[model samples]
Structures are given as structure tokens and as C-alpha cells.
Target: MTAGAIAAEPLGVACPMDLGWRYASGAAMERFLAGLRERRIEALRCDGCGRRYLPPRPLCGDCRLPLDRWVPVAAAGTLEAWSVYRLPILDGRTGEPRPTPYGIGLVRLDGADTTINHLLAETDPGRLRIGLRVRAVWREELRGALDDILHFEVAR
Candidate 1:
């Protein structure tokens, strides 16, 4: 036994993880994504407080009440916040690191009470600002996933 810190060989092996699993997006989210596939936007309206939730959930977080009211939300919205990633980040879908200098934004859609977080097409900070108008750019072939929205671009 050596004096001071005697590091033991770490008992571990490095290997690529290849696994698959299924998860439920739940009823509310299922409906929401379905709308996206059709290039439609919808939100859950709270009966108690009247707050509309994007990425519709089963209940209102503020009132703790069941949210079943589906209301049409505008395709365009006001940008409430934004960020530019100067560092490359891993793409969760591809499991690969993607080049950076991309923009992301929080948008408060008209007629909706809450903001939806999504990627922004405008990477130039000079072109991005709070309250900038943005609209979803849909894919040519729509799949019922959030990425069906290519990204929100600054509306002309």
C-alpha cells in the first residue's frame, strides 16, 4: 500500500450505448403535435385563470385545474427572449454535436398567455430583439414532431 492517495483502477468499460425506448407524449401533447403536422397551432386554455399553455399539458400549472379547452393559437408571435449559442451543442435527435452560432427564442404567440420555446432562424443578434415578430417555418413534408417547425424566422 502506497502512502497518500492510492488510486484504484476504475472498474469500468467504455462502450457505445445502443438502446431504444418508447415514451408517452400523453393525450394533450399528442393533440398538440398533431396540430403541428397540419401546420396548425393550438393551446390549452385554463378555465380558472384563462392562461393559455403552449405544448398543451393536462392541467394548468397556476390554477392546478384540468385543461381541456383547446384554442387556436396564432402561427406568428412576439419574441420575448433570445440567445445565441456560440459553442457547438449536441443535437439530441442525431446524438451528434452540431455547429453553433444558432439562435433560440421564447415566443408569446398572439392569443396565448404563455411563451413557447423554439429555435430562432435569426442568428444575428442585431436582428433579434424583444418583441420582434416571428413566424414558424414549416417543413415541406410535415412529421408530427416539434422539429416539424424548421425554426421561427423574423417576420417581414
Candidate 2:
């Protein structure tokens, strides 16, 4: 064994480790992603309070109702708020910092009261504005994933 491996052996650890799978996954997650792949979006609704949520959930936190029903959302949405991210964040899938100088926004998709946070493609800080119309840029292959809609762009 190499010296590094010998050192790690003392601690009951592997020299080269896979620091993966630090995530939280629940039952509703699969269905939630499936809808995105199918070009549909689903949100949970609180039957008691009449509130609708996007990215469906098992239960409403506020009203405590079992959330079911697949709802379709428009590809286009309104930008409620946005900001240019100077600091990079690790892209969960790639385990690398996302491309620098990107935009992130809270988009209030049509038919859903809650806004979904996603990457905005247009990097220019000046062009991004609140309430701007934005649309999804879909991937060529549908894989039932949020990345299926690669990113949102300013609607022309």
C-alpha cells in the first residue's frame, strides 16, 4: 500500500474517498423531477388555505393537507427578483463551481403562486430586471430533470 493509504488505514478510512451523496431525498422528489422532464411542472396545494405550490409536496406545511395532483405550468414565467452571482456555487451534479458571473432569479411561473429559483443565462447585470418575461431553454433530450430546462433567458 502507498504511504497515503497506510496513513488512512490507521483512521479506518480510504486514502481516496468518494465524498458523495450528502443530499436529502424524499418520496415526492422523483415525481417532482419527472414533471420537469415531461415539460410539465407540478406544485402542491393547500386545500385548507387554497394555496398552490410548485414542485409538489407530500403535505402542505401551512395547511397540513396531503398534496397531490399534477399541474401543468407555462414555459414562460415572470421574474419576481434576480441578482448577478459574483461568487460561484458548486453545481450539485458536477461537483464544481458553476460558471462564474452567472445570474440567478426567482421566477414566478404562471399558475403557481410560489417562485422557483433557477439560473438565468443572460449574464449582463444591466439587462436583468424584476418582472421581466423569461422562458425556459429546454435540453435536446428529455430526462425528467430540472436541468432538462437548461436555463432561463430573457424573453424576446
Candidate 3:
């Protein structure tokens, strides 16, 4: 090395990391899922529009008012919309890649005006329809997560 020569600097630092979040799901959602832990469901009612929402929100968009009124909703709801996932997605709870060929749907449970999006047990497109009646299937052990209801099955 030459006595007066300057040393070359390393370009950049390589620090790969796994990112995560720590949060409170909030009061409204906390109460709503707590209901799920007991196989119960509730929705926030819009006083003006009279719309009941599953997975209750703090305010009603249509009514533009605070939603504090709680209303009981049925476990069974009509299949408003659905789709079969051909790709694998990571499961939020397990932090694992969920298997492909799964089903997801939007359900407007009885007594609720808004639809709740969730998993459907029937993956076969032929067996699922827009107006199909489906019921929630609860897990044997309830953990208060939305997936506590494993999936909706075609109601008998």
C-alpha cells in the first residue's frame, strides 16, 4: 500500500430483519371477538341508517355517527360473495403459509346489514353459490381470534 493513499470504504451495511407489530385491536373489535370466543356474534347498529355491521366499527360511514349500539347477529348468513384462492397466503395467527385451493366469502349474517368477509369451508366452486346458506363452525378451543370459527359450512 502507498503511504499517502486513502483506504476505500465499504459501501453499505446489510442488516436483514423480521418486522412485527404490537397493538391493541381496539375496544370495538375486542368486544366483538370476545363475543366470538363464546360462539356469539354482535354488530354495531347505525342509528340513522339502521345498518348493523359485523366486526363492528366505531363509527358508521353511511350515517357518519358514532356506533355504540350493539345488536345480536345470527351465526348463519347468506353467501353474498366468494372466491377460491389458487395461491398460498400467510396465515396471520400461525405466521405460516396457508395451503392453496382454499375458500373465502362475504357473509351478511342475519340481523346485520353489512357483510363480513371470512373463510369458507367449501373450496369447490361448483358447490358454492351466491345465495347459499352457510353456518359458522366454531373451534373446539376458542382463542378469541376471528378464525375461532374455523369456516362456514353449507347450512343444513
Candidate 4:
């Protein structure tokens, strides 16, 4: 076939996939997870810009500097942004569908410059708002993962 003819031909392919994989969370994340098991919230502070990062990263995105300073962050924070989902969605950790009328929020935890996305206990749109004070509700059993926090609820 000529080069022009080959380029003109449509190409298509489809296949089923069942993939499994494993990855190392790295030293920074490992420490972060470990702290979660102890009910401690820690963040990495950038020396150059003084920006604190939750889930402790190895380097600062803005200053491009190494972030090794660990600081305590409060489990309570301000809800910066939020949404209410009325459709059932699969929970990646459990591989099950979460019921409809759920709430999710981007929370700026105290002492951290960044926000973390997590489930919100308040599903009613009328009660949820930006700058609302929220606190983490922990699971009965402690685990070294973000899921250790069941969800955030409006602080009384």
C-alpha cells in the first residue's frame, strides 16, 4: 500500500483487561501512613515558601525544594469546596457502590497550605457550605490509610 493509502485506512482494536499491580508508597508516604495509624496528622513544610503539604510530599511544588520538616496538622479544618452526589458510585477501596446522596469536600486542614479531598458526612446541600468547620470521624479500627477517617462532619 502507498503511504497515503495506509494513512487513510481506519484502525481499530478492542480487548478485555483484568490487571493487578503493586507499588511502593515511598519513604515520605510510608511515614505519613504510619502517623495515621497513631491518630496523628502530620504535614511537610517547605522551607523556601513555608507552604505546608498534607500527606507529606518529598519536595515542594512551588519552591522546588526538599520538604523534610514534619509539622502537626489538626484533624479539623475548613471546608473550602464541596459537592453532593445523588448517584451511586463505586468505592475504590471496597469495590462496592456507595449509596446515593453522598457529600464530598476539599478541606483545608489547619496548619496545611493544601487541601485534601474526602467524604463528607453531611449530605444535605442546605446544610453544607464553604468555610464550614468540619472534623474527621475515625473508624473504630485504626488503619494506616486515609480511609481511617470515615468522613468529615460539621463541627458543633
Candidate 5:
């Protein structure tokens, strides 16, 4: 086939995307992710709203106020709500969404005012429920990111 003909031919194409993001000058984010690496959770408190934010940020989303206070939260928390997803979507780190039958849960930490969205290790449909107490399972090494904690599991 000529160059023009080849270009016109029906060819399956897949365009990959980079989902990862690097926060420019994110001192607060650095600390937050570092805490997770150490199996510790951290949050930033908004001086104005008095709301503690998990995955600490320099600014409060609600009031758009600058947050400078740092608070350490517990690794253990309660499951505020959850749902089992059967459809695969893009994983945060990997561009490809993982296989189905995974549990995505909203976790309210012991000291935070908001819930964080994370993966749940236990996927038993019967065992999963609202108000379920869960705890963070940290990785063997500290990587300074949310992935440091592999997933939350039903607290024994």
C-alpha cells in the first residue's frame, strides 16, 4: 500500500495518557505523602474554617483559605461508605484501569474532618458495609505517597 493508502487504512490506535501529577512547590503535599510512607497520616487545618484536611493541602477547598497548621492523624479509621466496582477504570499510578471486582471506599480517619477515597483490600460483598471500621496497611517501604498504604482492611 502507498503511504497515503496506508495512512487511510483502518488501524486500531490507542493513545496513552499520564495520570500522575507533580505538584509544583507542594511542601504540604510532600509532608503528607511522606507521612503515609511512614505509616502515619497527616492533615492540614484551615485557620478560617477549622476543618482538617486529609492529604494535606496548602489551601482549603471549602473556604479557599490558606492552611498552615499541621495535624497528625491515626492510620486506623472507619469506613464511612463504600461500593464494589465491577468495571475497570484507570488506576492512579497506571494509565490502565485495574480489573473489576475491586472495592473503593470512603474512609474517615480518626482525627480528620473529611473522608478520603481509597481502595479496600477485602472485597467480600457480604462483609463490606457502611460504618465498617478499617485500618491502613502500610507498605514495607516508605515511598512518600498515598500508595504507601496499600489499602484499607477490615479492622480485626
Candidate 6:
């Protein structure tokens, strides 16, 4: 059979899949998450560019240098960019649809050079702005995860 005939044939196979899996948060991220459990924020600082990464990474994106310096970051940050979503979206953590009319933003936390995208507590477009100050709203029970911060609210 010619290659064209083979390509036209249906390629179907029966197989079972296991959707469950485990993810290993590396040393940098592990340390970052540990800080969250303690209600503290930390970032990895790159010596070359002097840029601090919120979700501490092994290497700097710009300098490509191994990041080993740890620095404290404020829970409060500036809303650099934002959008208000009117439709319900699936929450990855809970696997449920989040209530409609929610806000999300790229926040540049104090002491960090990069921005971290997170859910915003404010849904009002008129109230949201680029330079608006926001602070993390932590869950009553602290968990060593990004979701430990329920959301960020406008810092009054």
C-alpha cells in the first residue's frame, strides 16, 4: 500500500487512562510554599540583574544565573494590570466553577521584580486601576500553597 493509503486509514485504539498524577515542587518552590504556610512571603533574587522572582525559580530568566539568594517580599502589592471576568470559570484547585464577575490581575509585590498573576477580590471595573494597592487576604487555616491566599483585596 502507498503511503497516502496508509495515512487515510483510521488509526483507532482502545486504551484506559489514569488522570491522577503527582507533581514535585522543587526546592525553590518548596521553600516559597513553606513561607506561605507561615504567612510570610519570600522571593529569589538574581545577583546579575538584581531581579527578584516571586515563585522562586532555579535560574534567572534574563541572566540565566542560578538563583540562590532569598529575600522577603511584602504581601501587599501594586495592581500592574487587571481584567474583570463576567463569566464563570473553572477553579483548578476546587475543580468547580468560580462565581461570575471576578477580578484577576498581575501584581508586582514589593521587593519582587516580576509580577504574579492572582485572583482579585474587587470585581468593579471602575474601582480597579493599574496602580491600585492590594493586599493578600489569607485563609483562616494556613496551607502551604498559592491558594493559601484566598485573594487580594484593595488595600485601603
The whole-model lDDT of each prediction reads 0.90, 0.81, 0.89, 0.90, 0.83, 0.91
lDDT string, candidate 5, 1-156, tens digits? 457634565778797665657567478887777676667777888888889897677688889988889887888889999988888777676566789898889999998989989999888888998888999888888778787878899997
lDDT of 2 at 130: 95
- Per-candidate TM vs. native? 0.89, 0.78, 0.84, 0.85, 0.80, 0.85
Where's the lowest-lDDT run of ten residues in candidate 5? 1-10
> Which candidate number has the best TM-score?
1
Model 6 per-residue lDDT tens digits across residues 5-79: 345667789874436669999998999998999999999999999999888889998889999999999999999
**Candidate 3 overall lDDT versus native:** 0.89
- Judging by lDDT against the true structure, name the best candidate: 6
> Between candidates 1 and 5, which one is better according to lDDT?
1
**Against the true structure, what is every candidate's RMSD?**
2.6, 6.1, 4.9, 4.5, 4.4, 4.3
Residues 1-156 of candidate 3 have per-residue lDDT tens digits of: 454466777479887556788988899999998998999899999998898877788898877999999999999989999998888877776778989888899998988988878999999999998999999988999998888989988897
Pairs clashing in candidate 5?
A: 89-97
Better of 3 and 5 by lDDT: 3
Task: List candidate 3 stretches off by more than 4 Å.
Answer: 1-16, 90-95
Off by over 4 Å in 6: 1-18, 92-95
Give the true-structure RMSD of model 1. 2.6
Put down candidate 4 lDDT per residue, 25-81, tens digits, no spaces.
Answer: 999999998988988999999999998998687899888999999999999999999
In TM-score terms, candidate 3 sits at: 0.84
| TM-score: the better of candidates 3 and 5 | 3
User: Model 3 Cα displacement at 112 (Å)?
Assistant: 0.8
Between candidates 2 and 4, the lDDT winner: 4
Query: Which segments of model 4 are wrong by more than 4 Å?
Result: 1-16, 91-95
- lDDT for 67 (candidate 3): 94
Q: What is candidate 2's CA lDDT for residue 156?
A: 92
Cα displacement (angstroms), candidate 1, residue 133, comes to: 0.7
- Candidate 1 residue spans exceeding 4 A from truth: 1-12
